[model samples]
Target: MKLARIYNVQFGKRIVTVKPDWLRVKAPQWERVGNVKEILRDLTLNTVCEEASCPNIGECFKAGTATFLIMGPACTRACPYCDIDFEKKPKALDPTEPARLAEAVRRLKLNHVVITSVNRDDLPDGGASQFIRCVEAVRTISPQTTIEVLIPDLCGHWEALELIVQGQPEVLNHNTETVPRLYRRVRPQGNYERTMELLQRSRQIAPWIYTKSGIMVGLGETNEEVRQVMRDLRAVDCDILTIGQYLQPSQKHLKVDDFITPEQFAAWKAFGEELGFLQVVSSPLTRSSYHAEEVRGLMERYPRQKVIN
Candidate 1:
């Protein structure tokens, strides 16, 4: 059930379809977009929406929701696929960041907030303390708001991971952005097994907290490879899965091998659910935290009693 649109581009001698019609997103309204921009500007907060150039920024902003990016905007890892600035030595963690983020949440009147940060490899805790502080501050300022933390792997730092699980966010997401074979090139700092370990161990530590992960297609991965990754995720008891089409940020980044069709995205959703994922959000436009707030509510409706951590 895709829309009627065809995208063809001339790379050199070949005309390639980079994006299909269904992948074309509607323009975001100015008023709602400006309101979100003004709030983040006034509060001095960063959002992954603007940082990552998310396609749904307008729609999400119009709906009065945003995924807040905390810590500094600079990342330690220089993943070519990523657009976040690389800093071998990013600035020291901001003590006031947590409170400021809480203030933004209070003003936005958000019911759910997704707090993500750049990789702070230099820190002893891998920036887990900042995440905890932000969560606590938000609870203090707006207890009604549920929290989700989109975290990095912390380079397999179990102690850091322990602090985060203990913080008890509604969702803990660490994306395995590509397949194992491609990890050497796409995510050289990341390990597929370690990513699995993070999700599996989180469930063990806080069984009540939902574990989630996401991956991008169109990076020279086969359909079978994608399914295998889903199987690996399920083995770790990951509760949620998100699959999306990968768009290259620049010419220096990896080229899009193919644009996955809407039909294929829908099929993956069905297959992942069949394999035991509690829920799956799959589409060309899906990202790690796409429609994050609504996804929480959908899962919460069929409540599972969680063991108090």
Candidate 2:
């Protein structure tokens, strides 16, 4: 099998081997990044930006925005493609976390916030209660801020999903991660059917809360397979979608099978929009929570009235 060549570009004195020119992220203002990091540290908060080794961390932190990672910096599942630490017996849930997260939001004075957690399969509610707590805490401190929870599948605990939906966040996101054909090798513990069911149930339970999911390319998936995943998401009435290129975190993790070009990402964006997604953010550097604040505009554009039961 022929492997794709990694491209190297010299930056002043340093030569870095990045996948493509399109993947290059500009250096962010470190002073601003440090300010955000200092706030997070002072509040004892964790963010997915740092835990996942996301390439856009500089951009996000510098912009004074971050995806608050509650429940832990340690995930229960050991998905090979992910960079988050895997711990079988992580620490007990911190009761102070929610308030601290809210403090961070207040200090940041953000108009929108994204809160996500590691897979806490060890917990009975799959950390759904924690999500509710965080959402409520943020609302208490920053009522003007819209909340988006990028959550786990809850190990198929429908009741827990109901509790979260009842919290009434502005958006509920559970990433499909990859095409169905790649689920076994890519996600291992993740079930494609369950992902679809979770998104479908979120829509059914709370049509007012936007349903969002994301997938990564350059992982040996065919274009048609990616398109089919979009179709599946739309069938479940998922409202927002994000598509991005997968970069190998380290040699220990999954190797990048290909480098998806900018043109390909643009094509996927167009296809997702045509499929009736209220918003489609597709680019080589796009992540599930990248520019997540934009959802505030989406909520205004497509306002959903809460259903009275």
TM-score leader: 2
List where candidate 1 sits over 4 angstroms from the true fold: 1-18, 87-89
Which stretch of 10 consecutive residues in model 2 shows the poorest summed lDDT? 1-10
lDDT of 2 by residue, 102-147 (tens): 9999999898899999999989999999999999999999999999
Candidate 1 per-residue C-alpha lDDT over 1-309 given as tens digits, one digit per residue, 9 for 90 to 100: 223244668989765556677677999898988998998998889998888778788889998899988877888888878877785468888898899999989988998899999888889989999999999999999999988999999989999999998888888998989989999989988889999999999988888888889999888888889999999999999989999988877666777777888898999999998998888999999988888887557656757576663
lDDT of 1 at 98: 93
Predicted structure 1: lDDT: 0.87
What TM-score do all the candidates reach, one by one? Answer: 0.93, 0.95
Which pairs clash in model 2? none
Please count the clashing residue pairs in each candidate, in the order shown.
0, 0
lDDT of each: 0.87, 0.91
Candidate 2 CA-lDDT value:
0.91
- How far does residue 270 in candidate 2 sit from its true spot (Å)? 0.7
